[model samples]
Target: MEARLKFAVALGAALVLPAAVQGADYFVTRQGNDANRGADWATSFLTVQRGVDALKPGDTLTIGPGEYPENVKLHGFGVPGKETLIRAELAGTVVLRGDRDVDLDFAQVPGRRFVYIADCKMDVLSVHEVDTLTNLAPAADPGALEFGPARYWHDAEAGKLYLSTSDFQPATCHRYTIGVLRDHGVDMLQCRRVVLDGLAAAGYRTAVGKEGLLLPTSGFMLHQTEQCTVRRCTAFFNGSGITINSGVGGRTDQPGEGKGNLVEDCRAFANRLDGIVAYNPSGETIRNCQSFLNQTYGARFYGGRAGDAVCLMSDVLAWGNPGADFWTKGGGLSEYNEAVLAERCIALRDCNFGNFQHGIIGGRNVYRGDRPHTIILPGEHEEFHQFNDAHFADPMNFDFRLQATSSFRQSGEGEAASGPHPYKADIYHVKPGGNDDLDGLSLAAAWKTPSRAVARLKPGDTLYIAPGRYAGDLALTASNICIRGRGIEPVVIEGGLRLAECRDVSVERLQFSGPARAIRGGNIELANCVLFGQSVEAEQVEGLRLNHNLLVASLRLVGCSGVILNGNLHAAAPAVQTDTRQAVRYSSYN
Candidate 1:
């Protein structure tokens, strides 16, 4: 077996140590010198690469603010019980830059129109070139570039670099922003149980000479690695943002190594290829994350290159990618194309097509301003046609919360768009005028109350309400049950609703007005609803989604975990408060 893949599989077994193993903590500061002892800030390392090179199995690397020009390749493995934490002393203040521009007077290429310069910084790869331009004439556009300039070429055979700026001034670059860097901000090889937190990685490179093309480079890359977590970090202006990658697949001698990682609370913007990409289908999770204005595409849950995975994405907001915000194509496995779950995600205005595309999606997911269909189904991608009628709160500035009066409010699903297999979900109608004696199956034979009619639900059951003044409150007891309002009118529940023991509950398109509050649910979704003159107190919410709702009063979560509050219109007064000390796992208050 290749050492990379074999090291990954060994992680599954439990090891009983003969002795209690303890780890050390190291500090890195901008003011400290690398030649020092590197034990504390007083004698800390100068660069992060020095600290990383000194890492042990259970070491903690606390890096302070400074510019790190070198790429950090994390070598050894760390066990889950003994994790290696490479975090900034403060979030978003530390920068690990891949490229450094020199004071250059582009040497006039002896009789040629362009000037040539070679300082050998591009020697990191076989064929050397700049990926993009910075501060040159017309700014860099998406999907096109120099290896690293406005106009540059590499003569690897002649051992020289050349460029043309028209103006003789030197330009800057964050070349290979998505793919190959001179190296990566953080590169993981055959690693496990590592944690990357609270840092900004930019000016990454993705051009590899042997490939003879501008390749992809991830600000943070995991190759033949598993069970790692990247939290509260930012990746921008790189070849690609964060990636949980599949290394060269298994050959006759070795197995492939990348799977089961988690990336959350991270923002990837203006990246060259994708903001965050998961090419390996290893049950990876991307939560509470946002990707916007990337040069090409935003975040890709599963590109389906060599295989497909059952990845989970919730409370994610992706927009303005020019390319689609999120992509999940039918990959290697036959069932892989359809084995993904998305919920309560706000995906909108991702180029000319649908905002989100997946094989199977759940209800209460607010998909607005996305087309041909909000949620593009599997097996119908080649026939994609952009459609109209989708709306947003403020797409020009990247806000996708539904306006209170949007016609598509709470209309996650009604009539499926044109596709090979349109969603055919069961719908149960509840109207105020209908009799309680009926079966509550249609609008004519609807139920008068919300509780009794919604009781008859299974996993995929949907309880749809018509516009009427209904009396009394409702409770959600089942898992994966959806309740939506009819598109034409508003459903008013005078008594409001309660969520005490519900699991995987979704409520959408209903107007609640009163002094009552909705609280205490597990894995609940509240989308496209308006709460006027009322307060909402949610508790024990493991995975909560509160999107596009108009709140006159505050919405509080007591013991919430992984709450996603996207595009909701809050009150001018104090409208939201939460004691969620845990990481904000999804798209935060918009």
Candidate 2:
């Protein structure tokens, strides 16, 4: 059966016209007019489902801006490269909404495995609107009825709902609000080439399973189909926002394939499960997306063929999530498969684990043996110094009254690489534009004046320093003032210095050694400056320059890439430990 399905699809693909050249328009409007041809803006159907029903190969359904009140399902209709488009009309909002206050019992649908709600809002039921029943008999008093109002009733037996208030009327009232009740939500299967644009799924009643008013069968569930696109949509407060069920044990019995699906620029928040899940599908891509505050992983990739799944996420941020910001369970996103690649992704305040994980809880599988893999860092060089054993003096113990010749003024080996300065500044006080009289009274103002001792003359002028012990850290910010340092041995800048965006700035041949970072600035040249942090103090400093410089953190550069290691890069602390046999080693360079 599966072979026959594949053959049929292959035949279909061969016979279908190229989708890019085919043009057809289907318009949707709030004012229902099915009789009107849905090809123009003026004559449009009110509901999205109507548009879906009318969708053909290579059709582009442009939905006009309005709030729709129905969950529409589009069965299979798609072609590769010529993907059908469903987009919002210019300056308009298209909403898919569920019927308010519908109930059904899921217990009645035997063998029912799943339900799906796509691009719609499921609203909650009001307490007063709930149906009430009472038993009655002849009363002793002529005016009195024999029976009283029934104390309890079931509203929703199985599915879900969207409610207006967080507070439940009766604690048990939540049981009957939404989900599988009579005439509840919509269900779709084997859908293809469907586009849900700028649609919101919200307003669910607070119930046990159907906490939100809109209890979907599932957010965007897929069983067996191909070529679909769900773009620029939001799904919130739903159970399992997006689920791709390929059958039991992450295996697919059907021969039909799910391919060429794209979910992009969408937001999923406060959902019960993962924002998106790809189950046993091949040739799918989820790009440039954001998911936050979901119950489970932000995005999950489960069972699939090797190299069949591709997730390209760039500039994405996930925060305050209980699970890992991005997780791959059930043999997904693991190096074992070599199919997943996560780049430039960040996780802030994620409590579950780091950015990546592998396999189900106990199912550990080694997909790759001792193969050479590349680990890319922000900077150009792969060499890193792990400062675990280095001990630094506590900043709290520092004495500002210490003499200029204090023992703390000594420079480390990497210190001489930085250029020299006149003022003898300590490691913590080496800032720009300051005056000290350690070797001899030297004022920033006097240093600027031209004389035989200085040769250079002018007020508000800056002086360059050579590589040596300086009495004080210089702090100079004057126009036409250029403080050049030696590039050979970085001039030792003793103290921590902070500079902001400035022009005509150059610092070379300087060793910054102290309890704090050496330099912090933008548009500044640090050619051969060595910044050594205090052995013990965790000082704050920007890692590198922004806009334009040798080392930067966040941005990418095309042709420029370099890294500098101050001393022997192979040096490690005695306590450093790793599983020698299990550890993957790589080439080292200085």
TM-score: model 2 vs. ground truth: 0.43
| Candidate lDDT (C-alpha), each | 0.62, 0.41
- lDDT tens digits, residues 216-288, model 2? 2345555554656667776654454555543223353332456556667777665555666556545666655
Candidate No. with top lDDT = 1
Give per-model TM-scores.
0.51, 0.43
For model 1, how does the per-residue alpha-carbon lDDT over 432-521 read when each residue is reduced to its tens digit? 687778765555566677878877777877777767777767665677788877654677877666776678888888887764344555
Q: Which ranges of candidate 1 are over 4 A from the true structure?
A: 1-22, 102-149, 154-181, 206-215, 247-255, 301-309, 320-323, 330-338, 346-392, 411-590
Instruction: For residue 547, give model 2's deviation from the true position in Å.
Output: 30
Question: Once superposed on the true structure, which residue ranges of model 2 sit more than 4 Å away at CA?
Answer: 1-21, 90-92, 99-194, 203-216, 244-256, 304-315, 332-335, 349-590
